[model samples]
Target: MHVCLFDIDGTLLNTGGAGALAMERAVGELTDGSDRPLDIPYAGRTDRAIVADIFRHYELDFGDAALRNFLGRYVEHLDEMLGQSPGLVLPGVERLLAHLHQREDVILGLLTGNFIEGARLKLRHYHLDAYFDFALGGFGDTHADRDEVARVAFNTLKAHRHPEQIDLRRLWVIGDTPADVKCGRAIGAKVVAVATGVYSSDQLAEHAPDYLAEDFEAVDELLELWPAIG
Candidate 1:
């Protein structure tokens, strides 16, 4: 079987600025100062890393208990903000996912930097969660490194589907960042990089992903990367 792992944030849908706003609000509630900047890069970074960065910036404790508290607040705010400013799903994502779902040989899963609940919330809001097999992918809580997440995904695939040896050649990681391309390479998997995120097509092409596209609008072009189904 061919396994495809997809990233959530910019690859499938844009969550407006809900994620950032949520984080800012969460930190503001937890911190003493209202003027402290909570700015941090989100692209290709895990929620765990983002939270850690926040704690580091503000010189707060990054212990498990503190993280839990902060994340709880962040999630709560995220849920609320998402309800108000739920972003747009990119071009051709829904149709492509539906088409891939019908392919017997293709196993669809998510490889995102979002916490499991956060990932679910975003996908559920957009009505796209049904396209993925939640039991067979990696989440941000696992590790800060995208490559580590890919390893976790491979392990999920092995435990759930392949009892014996699995070929890495059949694995594909699809996302819209250079980090996505790098992580895909880290696992010896082919990457299908999109230009739907902050990065342009030219920028993503510089990373030399196995497949590069402006978006998921062309189902046929994407299907070219997959093996023929029975």
Candidate 2:
């Protein structure tokens, strides 16, 4: 089978800042709206890393119990923020996913920085959750690094396809960030970087992904290039 791992956020869909906004609100609740200063970068970083930084910034405890509480609050606010903001699936994503979903040779899954539940929340809100096999996906909850998350996801895909040797040549990682490119290389998966997120095409090209597109509009090209996907 051709294993296809996808990133959420700026890759699958844009939450219109709902994710960041909810996170800000949740952290505010945790800190009681304390004086904000540090600007922790979010792009391509795992949720654990992000939260760890948040805790450090506000001098909050960075333990498991504390992290869990913060994430719980973050999730609750995420649901609320999703509704309050206008989120959208990127161009041609629906058609590409629909095409891949119908193919028996392809297995669709997520490899994202969002917590698995958080990933589901975003996907479910957009009605795209049903298309993915969550068991085959890796979550940010496991590690602070995206490459580590990619390794976990790689193993999950392997276990799910037990006895079937996965062809690394046929593996794929699709996302919109340089981190995605780096992580894809971690597992030796062919990377497809799209310019659907904050980064422009030129910026993404610097990462030199195997495939780069302005958006997911080139389904035909994907099929032609990745014949195993056929």
Candidate 3:
């Protein structure tokens, strides 16, 4: 079987502005100084890493209690923000997912930086959750490093299927950031870079991904280059 793992933010959905605003608000709620800017550099990072940065910026000690409180507020407001301002799935994503899902040899899963619950919330909000099997995902809760998350995802897939034979070489990782490409490389999965986020096609091209596309719009060409089915 062929396993296809996808990144959530900036790849499948457009939550850039909402995510930034939510982080800013979360920081403001925790910190005394309103003047302190919430520098939310979200690209190519895990939620824990971002939260850690926010805590450091506010000079707050990183502890479970503080982290939990911040996450609680962030998630509460995140759902509200998403409800008020719905995000869009990238072009051709729906069609691409449909095509891949029809194939018997393919398995769809997520390898994202979002915490598992956070990931579910985004997918559920976008109504994209049904396309994925959550049992096969790797999330920020498992590890802060993106590569490690990819490794975890692979293991999850293996456990779910319990395949009599397994071939890691047949795995694929799809995303829109340099970190995604790096994670794919780390785990030796075929990488497909989509220029739908911060990096342009030229920038992603420098990384020499096995496949690169402007967006999911070129679904036919993308699949032709690296078909999801094994």
Most accurate candidate by lDDT: 2
- Tens digit per residue, CA lDDT, model 2, 118-155: 99899999999989988987889969989999999999
Worst 10 residues of 3 by lDDT: 221-230
What 10-residue stretch in candidate 1 is worst by lDDT?
Answer: 161-170
Indicate the worst ten consecutive residues by lDDT in candidate 2: 221-230
Report backbone clashes per prediction: 0, 0, 0
Kindly provide the TM-score of model 1 when superposed on the true structure, using C-alpha atoms.
0.95
| Candidates sorted by lDDT, best first | 2, 1, 3
TM-score for each model = 0.95, 0.96, 0.92
Segments of candidate 1 deviating more than 4 angstroms: 163-165
Tell me which of candidates 1 and 3 scores higher on TM-score: 1
1-230 in candidate 3: lDDT tens per residue?
Answer: 77789999989999646766776777788775476765568888988888888888778898778877878878877877887775799999989888888788778899999877788888898888989999987887646688898888877877888655346666889999999999988877889999999899999999999888899998888777445444
Candidate 2 yields a Cα-based lDDT of 0.89
lDDT of each: 0.88, 0.89, 0.83
